[model samples]
Target chain A: MPAVIADGLVKSFGDTEALRGVSFEIERASVLCVLGPNGAGKTTAVRILTTLLRPDAGRAVVDGIDVVADPRGARARIGLTGQYAAVDERLTGFENLQLVGRLFHMRTAQARSRARELLERFSLTDAGDRAVKGYSGGMRRRLDIAMSLIADPSVLFLDEPTTGLDPRSRLQMWDVIDGLVADGTTLLLTTQYLDEAERLADDIVVIDNGSVIARGTATQLKSASGGDRVEVTVSDRDDVDRVPVVLAGSLQAGVEPVLDHAARQATLPMSSTDHVVPRVVRSLDEAGIDVVDVVVRRPTLDDVFLQLTGHRAENDTDADDDDSTSAAVPEGAAR
Target chain B: MTATATPTRSGPVPSDRHVVPTGATWLARDTWTEATRHLTATRRNPELLVFATIQPIMFVVLFVYVFGGAIQIPGFASYEQFVVPGIFAQTIVFGSAFTGIGIAEDMSKGFIDRLRSLPMYPSAVLLGRTFSDLLRNIFTFFIMLIVGLFVGFRLEGGLVDAALATLLLLAFAYAFSWIQALIGLSVKSVETANSAGFMWMFPLTFISSAFVDPSTMPGWLQPVAEHNPFTIVTNATRALYNGYDPGMDVVWSLVWAAGITVVFAALSFRKFTSNSK
Candidate 1:
């Protein structure tokens, strides 16, 4: 059986549908990253799989156990680190870990030993005795993740785990996640960071408007939209328009040309780096038009997100507003 | 199913099985850790500790000494003797508000969501908070008891009766903690929780026979005071302190405590699970 399988999951809060027939599967020992805008049902999906919320329709199984029917069994096998740091501020780091150990029914000595080990592993050993209230944001976040693993769950659900961390801390968290995946742990992570998904996920599922918009590996998704980005800079601004016409099969509508009027230069997109670049160069050479610079680049995850979702990831700040409004307003008022 | 050949350990014995806990045991361990941490937090904040114990003590002193002269009891020899047990019951009942306030703070700080994500039992969060509050209530009860002794109040009942009374008060306090938990979970802010809890508690305390005898109240107010759960607990506690048989009042108080606990626990649990989603 797949380590995690969510089939046509449909959930709604009153009039607003959070998840609309969302479905996916993750192989054991692999990482599956769910990417979406803030209100695109990523967190809702994680909550359902973690047994924190029951779906209005459809089913989810984690480690061969039904999440809804046998939540206790499913819960026993899953570790969850939610969007926010959930560590108790009043407790010391050691106490927090030890508490999770005890909750997992470890013997007093065993719990202490495990707490000591995790504190060391997370590099929180030095600050283990200090209360979490005094810890930095990154330290508390690390402790939160550590506490979740105290039970050694088979499946881990991390919902926007690095939402508010510094660049260094985010990279550190990525390394920790990588180590967990190396140890044959199946992870279902939801994140807004496209680079994070591209780097970490074996499979990527992009959700938009409460539904799955695309699903594949990073390469597959990028290739599905457009092969490669071919940029051409010409010496004359007017000549850039003629290049698209010269390059057959390359649509002028899809070409975004930027003209530098002061230098009389224009740039446009090309189809294939090999065939289109040489053909355009020869065509331009034959026309006595000088080329300033030419380069071909692979499509980034940002490009993939835009191609699949029809909106640039960076420009979609409305997603955050949607989430906050959806969360704050009463369900009845939403109607 | 058929048995399969097992591989032998290559080096040191694998302690993973014993080291890594799972299932119900894990939840039990987590709850204890949370409960102990909560207690330690209360200890470290000496201001909270002092206030929790002092407020009840001051109330006991104020009712017994300052107002004890003005209030008249028909059968009781001294006002302090009649009201001290009542104060014990009243103080702990009022102290129950802290459970809600603490929960509200945890919710606001986003700590409760962290607890929910762990593999611990869902009920553990509520249980841990309530248990910690119970311990604090016990400490507050004892402190008031000592203060009551110094101020001329005595427990005529032997050790067993005193113990039973203390247990009864704690049970009631525990039940009230669940009610507060529900409020904490439902309210929008921690400040609102404090105000709402105090508002509810003030009337509940004043309407009961905490400061004076129920018989001294007007005829219409007498029944309400006589039937109030706090009044029943206070009457039973007073009887226990006077070395008098508590009789049926013990059963009634216990019934109220258990019934309210079950009802409020169910409500709070429902709210907690729904809100977590």
Candidate 2:
């Protein structure tokens, strides 16, 4: 049976329809990632399902409890972590968790022991006694997630859990989420990062303007839209021609090799990169092509989204790039 | 802190570890939990605790010394004795504004949303807030008493009467505090809540017989002051603490307290449980 089911959920704020007939379901113990840009009803859907906001129209059930009819009952079976870290800044991390446990109706001793155990599990034991305001963003996020688990909720809704974090912290949070999946917790996450959804989700639901646009496994979505492309960076600008030439014969039929002189790079589009990659590298080495880098660039979520939405995933970003331009991320993440 | 408990797919929930007590048990437990959070915050921020005592002490000293020489009352022994109950009323009304400001701040901080998402009692937030503020008031009342003693303010009645007066004062303050909770929940910003709280409270306290007998006021304001709840409370408190005439005003004061609590607590609880804000 599905752990979560939302049929025809609808909500509005004044004139703005935040959600319009939104619907989806998630199997037990599996991860379903809700993908959408900011203000695309991702948070609204999560809020409705977690019993924080009541929908104007629809029926939602979690762990067999109706969200509309019995929100308090549904709340008992679900844990929610919002985009913002919702833990109190004035209280110590341990105090925050202890209060939540007590609110969950645990005995004093049980609450304390559970608080201690969670702090340790989240690697917050050393800093648990310190006020949450003094914690780093990553530590606060971890604590926020830890607080949600105090009652062992059957379903967890994490809305943009790693947003605004440095890449390193994002990786750390991902590892923690991965562990939750391993423990068989049904996870429902919402994020704008296609890579995050692709990496973490068992299934992905794409929503835009309060409606589901597409839904599928990450690999299937990628294959249905476009296949992988191989990126090769030649050390010498003059050898860029040899780069594509050596890769041409190994490429599949109907697939063409493209060369970029400015960046001294070559790209080959293919149905699959597994067999063609080794052949291209061997042929390049045989030709003394002097390659700086060789990477299999699977069609990014950006491409799949463009294929589906008829526009790039980001509203302001351009669609075209050198077939395999590396994501030009800044050196260090500021937030 | 995402992990509350590991999800168990099938079975009766563990009675000892994960039982979610409902109704009154849930309310009492959650209110106590939230109250402890507020108390812990106060301990972590000693400045707030110090200010709670210092503000009341300052009020008692300033009124008894600087203003005492200028004011006179016909029947009382001294102006300090006459104004002590008055000042107590003003201090508590002022303290009640914290209820509004605290809720506004919590709403702005997204803390209320988190609490609402939980399986806890709906009105526990307001109860916890009042609980903590009540504790703060009790502590400050003692500080004011010590300061009152040092400034020629005497206890002219029995010890039990003094205790009863304190409880009565707190009861009125708690009722007033619920109105502030309503204001706080209705406002958007904490700044607006704080400013609006004091703006309305100032007239209610000052227009009453808190610092001066209503008889000394202008003809029109005198009648208004005579019937004001603050005037009623101060008169009841003065009678209980100073061995004065125990008129129907004491009964009226309790009625006012109960009336304010029932109307405002119901309104505040309704606003709190609604989906708005």
Top DockQ model: 2
Candidate 2: where is the Cα deviation over 4 Å?
A224-302, A312-335, B1-19, B218-220
Best-fitting candidate, scored by lDDT: 2
What value of lDDT does candidate 2 attain over all alpha carbons? Answer: 0.82
* lDDT of model 1, residue A40: 84
Cα lDDT tens digits for candidate 2, A33-135: 9987677799999988988888889988898988888877787778889998898999999999988877776666667888998899899999999999999
lDDT by residue (B8-120, candidate 2, tens digit) is 33332335343455667567778888888888887778777777788888898899888899988888899888898888878877888888988898888778888888878
Docking outcome class, model 1 = acceptable
Task: State iRMS for model 1.
Answer: 8.3
Cα deviation in Å at residue A286, candidate 2?
Answer: 15
lDDT by residue (tens digit), candidate 1, B140-248: 9999999999999987898889899889989999999999999999998999999988797776777787777777779998888788898888878888888888899
Off by over 4 Å in 1: A223-306, A311-335, B1-34, B107-119, B214-223, B244-247, B270-277
